[model samples]
Target: MFIDEVKIYVKGGDGGDGCVSFRRERFIPRGGPNGGDGGNGGDVIIRANKKIDTLLDITSKVKFIAEDGGKGQNRNKNGKNGRDLVINVPKGTLIKDLKSGRIIKDLKENDEAIIIARGGRRGRGNAYFKSPTNQTPRFAEEGRNGRDRWLSLELKLIADVGIIGLPNAGKSTFLSRISSARPKIADYPFTTLQPQLGIVDLENYKRLVFADIPGLIEGAHSGSGLGNTFLKHIERTRVVVHLIDISAADLLETYNLVRNELALFSSKLSKKSEIVAINKSDILDTETSQIIAEELSKKISKPVHLVSAVSGNNVKDLIKAAADLINKESEEDLLRLSLPDDYDAISNKGLTF
Candidate 1:
C-alpha cells in the first residue's frame, strides 16, 4: 500500500537513576560517598531513505518509544545509556508537529536526518554533594523525564517532471515506456490511484525522474475524484507534462478543462513551466493528428508535440525537449540567485501561464 500521510506518537528514553553506596573494606579507614552518576537517555531520530516511497511502514506501527537507561550499580558504576530509535521515511517526507501544526522538517535529500525528540539528562550522584564542611552528604538528584510528542508525516514525491492529465490519458504508459517503472495499465479511468516514479535515461547516461500523477477530473480541485490527495506530490516538480488524448472529441475543450482545474487547485501550479503532448497518435491518421496538434497549439498558445506511447513515435524527442527545458529553467534559477541587484530586476519577469 502507498500511504502518503500518517500520524504517530514518538517518545525518547528516560534517564537512569543515580547509585548511592558506602565502600566497606577490611583495612580501609574512611570510605566516603562511593556513588556514580546516572547515564543519559536515548533520543528519537527520523532519517530520510531514498529507497522508501511511502509511509506504509510507519503506519503499521503507530507508537514508537526508545529504550530506557540502566540504573547505576552499587559499586559506583555508571549506568549504561539507552540506544536511540531511528525511523526511516521517504526522501520527500515532511514532519509536522501535531499540536502546533507547524512543519518541523522537510526531508528532501537522501540520508538527511533530524532529531524529533531529545533525551533526558542523567541524575547526579551523592558524591557530587560532598563538601568540606559537611562530611557525609546523602542528597542525589532525580533523573529527568524524556520528551514526547505527536507528529504528522506527509510524503510529497520529488520529481523533475510530472505527468498530469485526465484518466487513461496514457500517462502511466508513457512512464513505463520511457523508464523501467511498470504501473498497472487498464482501459478504464482512474487506473493509477497512486503516484508512480520512473527514471528516464537519455544519451551519455543522462537521467531525469518522472512522476505519473493520478487522473484529474472536473471537480478535482474541489475534493472531487482523487481530489488533492496526489496534487501535493506534483508541487515540487520543475516542469509538468500535460498529456491529452488525441482521440477524444473536442480536444481543445478537454485541454482547457484540465488547465482550469490546475488553476483552481493552485496559481503556482498553473504558472509552472508546461509542455503539451497529444498522446494516442497511433489511433488517429496523419491528417487528424496534425490537425489536433495544430489546433491545441493555437488554443494554448504553446508548442505541442504529437506522440504515441504505444508506437514509440517522437517519444525520444519529447523526452529530450522536456529535459532541455528543465535544464534551462535550472540555469535561469541559478542565475537569478547569483546575480546582483541590477541584474535581478531583469530576471524577475513574471511567469506566463
Candidate 2:
C-alpha cells in the first residue's frame, strides 16, 4: 500500500457565540452589563513525521475538522478555546491547494509543521460595547466562520542515489545486494511495481540512501509502463546509477533507450550525475565482460563498471565509484551556494553532467 498522492478536505473549527447577560445582584441595583467574550476556534495544522514513509494512512479518512470553541458564560467569564487539530505526514510530503494546484508547503524535514487552515476569531461580549454614555448596551457580536478548502498531498521519496534501468535490468537485485531492502526479483519483466528504498553504509561512517525505481519502457515519458509513475522520485536524488544487463543483445542501444526516456521526462533529471554499471557479469566470461565494458565506455564517452549483482563481483568498486562522485557533487553544490547571486555567470564550478 504505497500511496503517494491523495486529495482530502480540511476545515478549521468555528468560533463560539458571545453571551449577552446583565448583572443582577440583590444588593447592587446598578450592576451594568456583565457579558463574557467567546473563545477562538481551533486551527488545522499539518506536521512532518520521520516515521511515516507513505500517505497510506490518510487515505482511510477523507475529511478532517477541528473542534469548535466553547460558548461564553455569564459573570464576565471568557470561554475556553478549542484545541488545534494536528495531522502528521511523511517528511518529504508536499501539501498543495487542490483547486488552484498551488504548492502550500513542502515538508522536507522532520518535526516541521505549518497551519493549513486558520481558526475563526472570538466574538465580542455586550460589556465591550458599553461606553460612558451607554450604560446598558445589550448588543453582542457574532462569531465568524472557520476556513475550509480541499488539499492535495504528494510524496516524493528522498534518496541520495537512484537505481534505474529498463525492465528486468537487475536494478532491484543490485539494491538488495548493497542494502537491507529485499524487493521482488524474478526472471520476467516488470517484477518490481513499486519503488524500494535502502540505506548503504560505507567506510568512515558515511552512508547513502538508494532508491530502486520501477522499470522504464518505450514512451515512458508519456505515461507508458511504470516510468511515469516513478520518474518523479528520482528528482530529489543527487546521483543516479544506470544499471544495464550485460546479456542484452545491444548494450549501447539499451543504454541509449533509457537515457532518451530520462531526457524526455525531464532535462533536470537527465542532467544529474550518472554512473553506468553493466550488471550480470557472472553470466559471461571475465575477458568478454571486460571487452564489452571497454567498448561501451568508448561509445558512451564515459567510464563503465562491470559487476555481478548475484555473485557480488566488482560490486564494491561500483559502490566506491558512486560514493566518490556523490562526495564531489556535494562539494560543488556547497561551493555554488556560498557564491554570489550571479554565481552561474561568474564561474562554471558546478556538476558538468
> Evaluated with lDDT, which candidate comes out highest?
2
TM-score of every candidate = 0.91, 0.92
TM-score for predicted model 1 compared with the true structure? 0.91
Go through the candidates in order and give each one's C-alpha lDDT: 0.80, 0.81
Which runs of model 2 end up more than 4 angstroms from their true locations? 330-353
Candidate 2 residue lDDT tens string, 1-353: 78888898998888877888889999988888888988888999999887777788999999988877777777898778878999988877878899999989878778999999887878878888889999888888777778999999888877777888989999988887888777889998899887788777877426777788889988999998764877877777778999999989999999999999989988877787899999999998999999999999999999999999899898888888888887887666733322100000001111111
Stretches of candidate 1 off by over 4 Å are 331-353
Q: Could you tell me which residue pairs clash in candidate 2?
A: none
lDDT per residue as tens, model 1, 275-313:
999999999798988987997798779999999999889
